[model samples]
Target: MDGIIVVNKPKGMTSHDVVNVLRHKLKQKKIGHTGTLDPEASGVLLILAGKACKALQFLKDTDKTYQTSIEFGYITDSDDIFGNKIEVKEINYDFDFEKVLQSFIGPQKQKVPMASAKKINGKKLMEYQREGISNIDVYNEIEIYSISVLSKENYSFEVHCSSGTYIRSICRDFGYKTNNLCCMKELVRTKVGRFTLDMAQNLDEIEIDTVKLYPLSYLLDHIERIDYEPVLDIYNGKHVRIQTNANQVCIYDKEKPIAIYQRDHFDVFKSIRGLW
Candidate 1:
């Protein structure tokens, strides 16, 4: 029960709902999910149960890819098809979607969606919405790594972005950027770093012993491993020295990760996470 399982989350269930369902089904506590998927969205949801929960930080550092469709003739108050309509415009069939999509390839600033999980004044933005509060003072500096047009008729596209980027905001921005009333119609997260839809299982599909593995295994290409005695020193909360050309590195005791070490501006090793 102490590993990560990919759940192809069903629509209309909050990420917390998935955790509660799995908790009831498996009868194990201490379960956590890497990222929150909107209730209307369905796709890869990484569940970290038991010791795998410790790897949450490692998984959050990776990128996410989603396949989403946008409707261009109408906008909703919630920015998706499920919300109340706020605007409408005639669809423009001649617009250059490719070039418009290309314009958003790099870094950008986005306002946190009103219905998002971001908190303000001790309440989530969504909570604020229910209480008739609508002002937010936060914005996110996010990068859209890549975007490709999947289908022109329905405005389906695949986007790979940094973990915290909001796909709903992208849809909202695209509508205004094009002077159209746009709303997200459908969304499916295809991947979260190495975890993909193909690796996901239903609640009935979990095989406890067979599905769990050390999450740090996904970062092997970017990290150098340590095999010496400092593994125990760091585990015991003692400072230890290690060498690495990378800024952050993971120390391992044979096949198990012991700690994540980082350099002080790439100069000295400092343990960041202790797995022991």
Candidate 2:
């Protein structure tokens, strides 16, 4: 129970709801998710139960990939189809879809939608929406690593992006770039860092005994590992000198992660968190 559970979260349940359900089923009090998946979206959600919750802070910067469909013709108050219609336009089917998608392949600022969990002034945007306060403008830096069109006929595409990049905003921006209104129709997070949908267990079908909890080494496989003898320095959160090109590394002993280390100086590494 002290490891990662890759849950294929169903649509209509908030990420918190999944945690609550698993907590009840597993009877584990300390449980958390790596990232928040919109209630309307479904797919891979990494659930950390017990000691695995400690890895949450370090995992936030990991990149994610999503498969999403866009509907062109009109947009809603929310960036997705669940909101009130705010604008309508004819679909520009003749536009160069490939070129437009490629244009979004680099770093750019995205407008945060009103109907989102993103907070402004300590209040979630969604909370603001419920109170009839709609005049808020928020933007954040995002990068689209790659975008592969699944089917242009249906405006379906897969995007790999930075952790905080909103796929809904991408759909909205894509429509505006093509001179048509558009909204996200459907979304499924296919990947988060090294975790994938193929590794996910269906929430409804998963059982306590059937659940697969990945070890810390597997859960944090993306991080560079340095196998060394167990020492008091690592356990006491002390800095150790280790040669590595990576900005962060996991110190391992007998193939098990003992502590996560970050560079303090040139060769000196400071314990950021002890995985043990």
**What TM-score do all the candidates reach, one by one?**
0.86, 0.89
lDDT of 2 by residue, 1-276 (tens): 788899999999999999999999999999988879999999999888887777777664379999999988899989899889988887788787778888899998889999988988899998998899888989989889999889878889999999779999999999888788999999999998888999999998878889999886666777998875547778888778887799899887777777889999999888888776
Q: Evaluate residue 78 in candidate 2 and report its C-alpha lDDT on the 0 to 100 scale.
A: 90
> lDDT of all predictions, in order shown?
0.78, 0.87
Regions more than 4 Å wrong, model 1: 135-137, 207-216, 219-221, 230-234, 243-248, 262-272
lDDT of 1 by residue, 93-212 (tens): 666888888888988887778878887778888888778776665688889999999988778899999867888888888877887778788999989888888878765565544444
Screening candidate 2 with a backbone cut-off below 3 angstroms (N, C-alpha, C), the clashing residue pairs are: none
| Shift in Å, residue 88, candidate 1 | 3.1
**TM-score of decoy 1:** 0.86
**Residue 137 alpha-carbon offset, candidate 2, angstroms:** 1.7
